[model samples]
Target chain A: MKDIILIGSGNVATHLGNSLKKRGFNIVQVWSKHINNAKILANRLDCESTSSIKQLKKADLYILAVKDDAINQIISQLKDITIVHTSGSIDIEVFNHRVSNYGVFYPLQTFNKNVDLDLSKTPICIEANNKKFENKLMNIARELSRNVIQLDSESRRALHIAAVFACNFSNHMYTISEKILSESNLDFRLLLPLINQTVTKLKDHNPSEIQTGPAKRNDKQLIDSHIIGIKDAKFKELYTLISNSIISHNE
Target chain B: MKDIILIGSGNVATHLGNSLKKRGFNIVQVWSKHINNAKILANRLDCESTSSIKQLKKADLYILAVKDDAINQIISQLKDITIVHTSGSIDIEVFNHRVSNYGVFYPLQTFNKNVDLDLSKTPICIEANNKKFENKLMNIARELSRNVIQLDSESRRALHIAAVFACNFSNHMYTISEKILSESNLDFRLLLPLINQTVTKLKDHNPSEIQTGPAKRNDKQLIDSHIIGIKDAKFKELYTLISNSIISHNE
Candidate 1:
C-alpha cells in the first residue's frame, strides 16, 4: 500500500484524510501549522501528527492541502518528496526545482469539516510532472473517486474561477435571499423548495436556457420594484447589475 | 372535482394546468393574450382554449396565472366567479373589491413549461378573505401538493423578493460561471459536480455556516487574483462586492 501524508488540517485536508482512510489507503502522517489541528485530524485517522516540517516522515505521496498563499511558504521549507496540491487556482509549476516530482490532486467539490461526503462520485482532477508520477497519482485518485481525470494547470485555474461564480457567489445569493426574507419577518425556509428546484432543473436543462424571473423576462416594472424594495445600497446595486446582466445574457 | 379556468399560458400557467389535471381537477378552459399559446396549453390539458376573456367558461375556480401587470386588466373584464390569482407579490386584496369570493393560490416554486414538477412537495401559499373560500382553496391546493400553507400578502411579497435572490440571481451566477468557462475553452460540465455539491451541502447545514472559498476565508491575495483574472469589468465589480459581503457576513 502506498503511504500518504496530508499537509493541512482545514476542510479539504480533513475531508481528504477521512476519505483516503476509508478507501484503505495508508495515511502515514498528518501535519498542520497548528499542532492542535494536526492532532485533531491525525487522531481521527489513527496517524502520526506533527506541526514541524522536519518531523514529516517519508511517504510515497505528500498532499499539500494548505491555503493558496501558504503553499509557497510551506513548499519552500521542504524538498525531495513526491508532492501534489489540492488547490484549484495555483499553478503546478510552484513546485518546480523544489521537488523531484510534483502534481495536483484537486477535488472539485465544496468541503465542510463536520459534514461527511462520499468522495467516490466527486470529480478528482489530477495533474503531474512526469508520466510515471502521473500514473501513480491516478492510481491513488481512482481508489478515492470514480470520476478521476487528468486536468492541466491552465484549465484547472479556469475551473477554479468558474467555481467562484457557481459555488461561492451562488451561496452568497442565498445569503442575500436570507437577509431579504429576515427583514420582512418571513422565514427563509419558504425559499428552500424554490432553491432546490432551481438546481434540480439544471440536471436536465442548461442554466442559460432555463433562466427565469423579472430580469430574464425584462419586466421593467417588477425589476424596478425589486430595486426600490431592497433597502441595502450594496444589495440594490447588485440587484441592478445582475438583473441587467441577466437581461443582456438572455437577449 | 373543481372545474378550473386558467388565465395565461406562461410557465406558471402551463405547469399549474398540467399538475392540476394530473390531480383529477377539471381544467375546463385555458386563456392567453396570444391564441397560439392558449391553444397549445389547452390542447395539452385536453381543455377548451381562448384568447378572449368573453369565451371563458363558467368554472368553480378561475386561476388568473397572468403576469402581475396583466392581472388588473384581465380581472377588470371578469368578476364574481370565485377567482384566485397565482402570484407571490400581488396583494390578495386585489380581488377583494371585484369578486365576492377570491383568494391567492401561489405555488412557491420556479416553473418551466417543458419540465414537469411533481408539486407533491411544493409549498402552495394561500390567502383569502373568508374561512369558507380559504378552506375551499386549501382543499384544492392540498390535492395538488402536500405543502399547502396560509401566507399573507406581506410575507409572500417578502418571500417573492427572496426567491428572486435565491432562485433567479443564483441561476444568474451559474450563467456567469458558464460564460467564464466558455471563454477559457473549458467545458461547463466540469463545474456541474461542484454546483451539485454546493447545494447538497445546504441540505445538512445553513448556507452561511457551510460557505467556502476565498471570500469566506477573506484571503486578500486569492480574492485579488480572481478580481484581476476576471476580464469582464461588470463581473469583476460583482466579484469584489460579493467577496466583501461574504467576508463581512462571516465576521
Candidate 2:
C-alpha cells in the first residue's frame, strides 16, 4: 500500500482523503491551517492530524490540497518528497525547488464537502516533471478516478478560466433567475425542471447548436420587453451584455 | 374527448401535440405556413393537415403555438372559438378581440422537436380571462403535467425574462467554455462532469451561497490572469462584465 499525507482539510482535501481511504491507500497524516479542521477530517480517514507542517510524517506522497495562494508557502516547508497540488490554475513550478518529485493531480470538477460525488467519474488532469513521478501520480489517480489525462500548464490554466464561465457564471444566472421569480411572488423551484432539461439536452447536442431564447433569435422586440421587465439596473445591464455576446458568438 | 387544433409545427407545438395525443386528447387539425411541415406533424397524430387557416376545423380548443410576432395575424383569422397561445412573454389580451374565450398555456421548459422530454414533469403556467376558461385550460394542463400553475400575465412575463437568463445565458457560458477548451486542443467532453456537478450542487444548496471561482473569491490576481489569457476582445469584455456582476451580486 502507498503511504500518503494529505495537506489541507478543505473541500478538495476532505473528498480526496475520504476517496483515498476507501481505496485502501494509507493516509498517514492530514494538515490544515486550523487544527480542528485537520482533526475532523483526519479522524474520518483514521489518520493523524496536524496544524503545523513540521508535524507532517514521512509518506510516499504528500497531496497539497490547499488554496492556490497558500500552496507556495506550504511548499517551502517541505523538502525532497514526492508531492502534488490539486489546483487547476496554479502551475507545477510552485513545487519545483522544494520537492524531489512534483506534479499536478487536479480534478477537473467542483468539490463540495457536503455533496457526495462519484470521484471516479471526474476527469483528473495530471502533470509531472518526469516519467517516474508521472507514473506514480497516475497510479494514485487511477485508483480514485477512471478518467485521467496529461494536461500541460497552459491547457490547465485555460480550462480553469473556462470553468469560471461554465460553473461560476452559470450559477450566477440561477441566482438572477431566483431573484426574478421571488420578486413576482413565484417559487424558484419552478425553474428546477427547466434547468435539468437544459443540461440534459447537451448530452447529444453541442451547446452552440442548442442555444435558444430572445438573444439567439435576435428578437429585438422581446429583448426590449425583457429588459423593461427587469427592475434591477445591474441585472438589466447583464441581460443586455450577455445577449449581445451571444449574438456576436452566433454570427 | 376534447377536440383541439394545433396551429404550429415548431418545437413547442410538436411536443405539446404529441403529449396531448398520448393522453387521448383528440387533435383534429395541424396547421403551418408550409404544407410539408403541417403534414409531418399531422401524420404522426393521425390528424388533418392544412396550410390555410380557412381549412381549420372548428374545435373545442385551439392552441396557437406560433411565434409571438405572428400571433396577431393568426388570431385575426379566427372567430368566436376558445384559443390559447403557448407563449411566455405575450399577454392573453392578444386573443381578446377575435375569440369569445382565450387564455395562455405556456410551458416553462425549453423544447427541441428531435429531443424527447417528459412533458408531465414540466410546469405549465396557465392564465385566462374567466374562471371557466381557466378551468378548461387547467384540465388540459393537468393531463400533460403534475406541476400546473395559475400565473398572471405580469408574473409570467417576469418568469419568461428570468428563463432567458437561466437557460439561454447559462447555455452560452457552456459554449464559451467549449470554445476555450477546443482552442487548447482539449476535449469539450472534459467539462461535462464539471457542468453536471455545478447544477447538481443546486439541489441541496442555494446558488448564491454555493457560487465558486476567482470572482466569487474576489481574487484580483487570478481574475486578471484569466482576462489576460482571453484572446477575443468580446470574450474578454464578457469575462470582465460577468466577474464584476458576480462581485456586485455578492456584495
Candidate 3:
C-alpha cells in the first residue's frame, strides 16, 4: 500500500485523507498545530495524530496542506522526504532546500468536511520537480481521479484565479441574492432553480454565449431600475460594476 | 386546442413559443416590429407572421413577450383581448385599458434561444387582474410546469431582483473566470465542476452557510494577494468591495 502522511487537519487535509483512506491507501499519520483537529481526522481515518512536526513518521509521500502563508514555515520544519503541497498559487521552489523531491497536488475543487466529495469527478492538477516524483504523484492521482492534468506553477496560479471568479464570486452572488430576497420577505429558495439552470448551461455552452439579463441586452431602463431596487449601497455598487462589465463584454 | 398568439419574437418569445409548441399548443401567430424576426419564429412554429400590430389576430391567450419598454406600446395597439406580458418587473396595470383579463405570465428563469429550456422544471410566476384570470393562467402554467408559483406584482419584482443576482450576476462571475483563464491560456472548462458544485450547495444549504473564501475566512493576507493578482482595475475594485461585504456579513 502507498504510505501517506497528511500535515494538516483543515478542510482540504481532512477530506483528502478520508478519500485516500477509502481508496485503501495507508494514511500513516495526520499532523496539525491544533491537536483536537488532528485527533478528529486521525480518529476518523484510524491513524495516528500528532501536533509536533518532529513526531511525524517518514512516509512515501508527505502532503503539506497548510495555509498559504504558513507554507514556508512548515517546509522549513519538514525532515526531507518526498513532500508536496496542495496549494494552487504557491511555488514549488519554496521546498527546494528542505526537500529534494517536491511538487504540487492541487485538487481543483472546493472542500468542506460536512459534504461528501467524489474524487473521481474532481480534477487533480499535478506538478513535480522530476519525472520520478511526477509519475509517483500521477499514479496516486490516477487512483483517485479520472481527470488529471499536469499544470505548471503559472497555469496553476491562473487556474486558482479562475476558481476565485467561478466559485468564490459565484457564491457571493448567491449571498447577494439571499440578501435581496430577505429584504422583501421572500424565500431565497424561489431562486434556486434559476441558479441551478445558470450553472447547468456551462455543461454545453460558453458562459458568454449563454449570458442573459438587462446588462447583456443593454436594457438601460431595467438596469437603472435594478440599481434603484438594491437597498444596500455596497451591493448597488457591485451591481453597477458587474452590469458595466457585462455591457463591456457584449460590446 | 388552446390558441396562443405570440406578440413578440425576442428571446423569451421564441423560447416560450417553442416550449408551448412542444407541449401541443396551437401557436397562431408571431408578431414583432422586425418582420424578419417574427417570420423566423413563425416559420419554426409553422404559424403566420405579422410585423404590423394592427394585424394581430384574437386568440385564447396573447403573450406579449416584448421588452419592458415595448409592453405598453404593444398593449396600446391591440384591442380588447386576453393579453399577458412575460415580464417579471412590469405590473399588470400597464394593460388595464387594453385587456380586461390581462395578467403577467412571467417565467421565473433566464432564457437564451440557443440553449434548450426545460420549462417543466422552470417555475412559472402567475399573476392576473382577477380570480378567473388567475385560475385560467394557473391552469395554463400547470400544463407547462409542476412548479407554478402565484406571485403578486411586488413579490414578482422582488423575485426578479433575486433572479438578477442569481442568474445574471452568477453568469458574469463565470465570464470573469473565463477572461482570467483566457489571459493565461488556461482552459475554463476545468472550473465548471467547481461552479456546478457551488450552485448544488444552494439546494440544501443557505448561501451564507455555504460561503467559503479568503473574505469569509477573514484571511487578510490571501485577500491582499488576490487583489494584487487581479490585473484589471475594475476587477480589483470589485474583489475588494465584495470581500469587504463578505467580511461585513460575518460581523
Candidate that would win on lDDT? 2
Fraction of native contacts, model 3: 0.73
- By lDDT rank, best first, the candidates go 2, 1, 3
Candidate 3 displacement at residue B13 in angstroms? 1.8
Compose the digit string of candidate 1's lDDT tens values, residues B120-185: 888999999889999999999999888898988888887888899899999999988888889878
Candidate 2: interface RMSD equals 0.8
* Model 1: docking quality category: medium
lDDT of 2 by residue, B76-126 (tens): 888788889999999988876666788999999999899899998899999
Candidate number that wins on lDDT, 1 or 3: 1
The residue pairs that clash in candidate 1, if any, are none
Tell me what TM-score chain A of model 1 achieves: 0.98
TM-score of 1: 0.96
Q: What's the DockQ for every one of the candidates?
A: 0.75, 0.84, 0.75
Q: Predict model 1's lDDT versus the native.
A: 0.88
Best by DockQ: 2
